[model samples]
Target: MSEVYGWEFSDGPGDHFAVTADHLFAGIWSRPELDLRERRLLLIGALTAQGQFDVAEIQLGAALRNGEFTADQLREMALFLCHYVGWPAGTALDGVVGKVVDQQRKSEQANKTK
Candidate 1:
């Protein structure tokens, strides 16, 4: 939600559609048909399959922060993805997930020491 690529809906032409799409998806996700964890797992699979690492990283981060997934579970998921998405995609996802877990640990430690 924080400025995507530093561009906001009021930034210029074509921005409106981007904002609209974001809002629409938010509303769609608000429905109770599916658990948020399930949606996040599906998104992680889709993004990883599509080789959308950056987007996948964001979703994975959310999954971690929200307690939807643990680091060990994510690593297991990455391994499971390898058979379907190929080693490179799975490896890239693992790298990103590892970094996210590391960041979370660092942040937690920092807070504890304060």
Candidate 2:
């Protein structure tokens, strides 16, 4: 949660939602089938299909951080996804991927400076 949002959450207000989400994420992530990269790709596909660019943005950034996919690869994947998700959603996905790629590069540069 903190990694996704770039902030720590207090176990005070709205704690139930966060706690529930934590448990759900843990359960899903702990399951022995697909690796994180595979799961992330599936999630990106679902989110993009639904036009959920905001959440997809988070996933994209995490993918870059985790070295799951390169920007070029993601862009290529988005192009391939266009046929299945339709051009509109696929275009949106491409835009978010570009945004995340820039953000990741900036973050890496900042970390190096520090």
Q: Which candidate tops TM-score?
A: 2
Which lDDT tens digits does candidate 1 get at residues 1-114?
322222233333677867776775556565679877787888899999999999988877778877889999999889999999999999999998899899879978999999
Task: State, as a TM-score between 0 and 1, how close model 1 is to the true structure.
Answer: 0.80
The lDDT of model 1 is: 0.80
lDDT of each: 0.80, 0.84
Runs in model 1 with CA error above 4 Å?
1-22
Scanning candidate 2 in windows of ten residues, the lowest lDDT window is 1-10
Q: What is the C-alpha RMSD of each candidate to the true structure, in Å?
A: 4.4, 2.5
lDDT score, residue 4, model 1?
Answer: 20
Clash pairs, model 1 backbone:
none
Question: Could you tell me the lDDT of residue 85 within candidate 1?
Answer: 94
